[model samples]
Target: MAENSSSTPPGTPPEDSRPRPQYGELAPEGWSWTPTPDERTLATPDAPVSSAAPVAAPHPRGTAPRWDRPVTLSLLVLGLLSTLFAVSMLAMITDSIQLIYTQLDLGGYEPDPSVPGLVTAGIVSVCLVWLATAAGAILLLARGRRAFYVPLIGAVLFVVVFIAFSSAVLATDPTLLNDPNLMDVYGSL
Candidate 1:
């Protein structure tokens, strides 16, 4: 009925005969292993440890700015400016039309029916270009779509082409280009 007093379990070598751990002596009963500050604390002994915190996954960079931010505000302002340009272009077309109509009423000049058709076509084309540009701006501002660049470039090219065409057409018909009466009407608007 007596309790055993031996340090080693039955069949194991005696405590004095076993090799000692290199770093520390055998701990007393109920002693548990714990890591030092220099050593990483691990959820479990078998878990991997590092001197520093686990590497946080890198976040993506160069994301588009939010709507409430400065970039978005700039785009909105540009869009408003574009809208104003479009409106001014429309007003110019209207003034041009009114000038032609007034000239026809006075019988001082006869209208070339072809002029109206060509002017109408030009205005329509310009309007289409402006619309496409506005759409591209919206897409760029809202969704950060790089595809908007294509339409934006096209719109710019269209504007250049329109100016060149208008200049050429006006140059060929000096009366249409130099009419002081028409210039006055458009200038008034």
Candidate 2:
């Protein structure tokens, strides 16, 4: 071979013309790269290792999550209860009116003493119930429950209808006065 300008160092044969080994690489005879015990353990592939523990089972889908807000549930319950109470009162008034009409034979008769008071009381009760329902609905909506709004509005409208019906009944029959016999019953007051 042509004289290799890349000569070996002194006290070494020219056969060592290859590149010197790095600190981490295998060395010449009588020397070798040996990994530490920890390095050897890591390098030995025993089994696949996971960095984190397994997670618990996930919750089922499509069910409503548990509610944390007490006010929301309270408002919903209040709205429902108030609605039921108003409906019950209205139904009672209706039944009473029907009974009066049927028993007194006054289905199409002129306005009389007993009937006017029932109509007036029904109207007042309906108005009061409507106010209560409206208040409950407002609370429910403010607490993020939107389902109660329609029923609440319906209750208010029903109250208005009752008021109108009462007014018409009173206006059509002048005998539907607050005191037809005022001079007899409460003339002192």
Best candidate, lDDT: 1
Models, CA RMSD each: 11.6, 16.3
List candidate 2 stretches off by more than 4 Å: 1-145, 178-180, 183-189
Expressed as tens digits, the lDDT of each residue in 42-121 for candidate 1 is 43378566799788654345344343235444544554566456545543653554566566453334435455565566
Model number with the top TM-score: 1
Candidate 2, residue 118: lDDT: 55
For candidate 2, the 10 contiguous residues with the lowest summed lDDT are 62-71
Candidate 1 Cα deviation (angstroms), residue 21: 14
> What's model 2's lDDT at 142?
57
Candidate 2 structure quality by residue, lDDT tens digits, 16-123: 566756774766667766779998988788866778997655545432223423444464455556546555554455454445445544454354555556565665
The C-alpha TM-scores of every prediction are: 0.40, 0.26
Q: TM-score for candidate 2, please give it.
A: 0.26
lDDT of each: 0.55, 0.54
Clashing pairs in 2: none
